[model samples]
Target: MVKRQAYQPILITDASRSQHDQLRSRQLRYIVMMSIRAACLVVGAILVGVKPPLLWLWLSLCGVGMVLIPWLAVLLANDGPPKEKYRLANRLHRSQRDETPPRSLPAEERPHPVIDAEQ
Candidate 1:
């Protein structure tokens, strides 16, 4: 009688998020960052109009945020999830010298069927 193999269950943790979900998340992050940048511009304008105390410092902070946020947002939006450790490209490249040579099984022990020319 042939033996049957046991069933193996797939784990959900191993699955990656869908591309649409990932893209939606990245788009949301970019929008939030841009919103913050707009807030900085508005704050800078308000500081200029009011001539607040330490006006230069307030303007500088806002200016820095306005300049840096878009650049950072673009970088983060373009970035993807990190590669898995077990992926072939991410695995360490080993030289042939570091590996053990493949072992050959003896003819008597090998599972292949023997064919006879006389049969």
Candidate 2:
């Protein structure tokens, strides 16, 4: 029995990527939080005049969501690309056109093809 190889991960290494991606993600988070805050504030204002019982809980959740936005942004920003992808792609592209052909599956085996039960 032959063991199959695992697929490699992608790499991302543009210097500005980390900075720009972080900044953009943070900006998006801030915008979303601010919009939600404004919405809740408006609702609270309208409800305050009539004394809605659920206003306190609604305002509390919005406040907490506003406070957590930046932390969430940071988490989103930290998931950038790995460092090995560019090198691997280059190696694959080079190997494809080189004098030596790309590697082949073992000669003794043929891969299975899927069949549709309906057919």
Highest TM-score among the candidates is held by which one?
A: 1
Summarize candidate 1's per-residue lDDT along 47-74 as a digit string, tens digits.
Answer: 9999989999999999999999999999
How far out, in Å, is residue 48 in model 2? 0.3
RMSD in Å for all candidates: 12.8, 13.9
- State each candidate's clash count: 0, 1
lDDT of 2 by residue, 11-111 (tens): 33222345567677766766675676577567666667877678788767756765675566556555554445674575567556555323364422322
lDDT of each: 0.72, 0.55
The pairs that clash in candidate 2 are: 11-85
| Index of the highest-lDDT prediction | 1
TM-score of every candidate:
0.66, 0.37
Candidate 1 regions with alpha-carbon error over 4 angstroms: 1-6, 84-119
Q: Indicate the TM-score of model 1.
A: 0.66
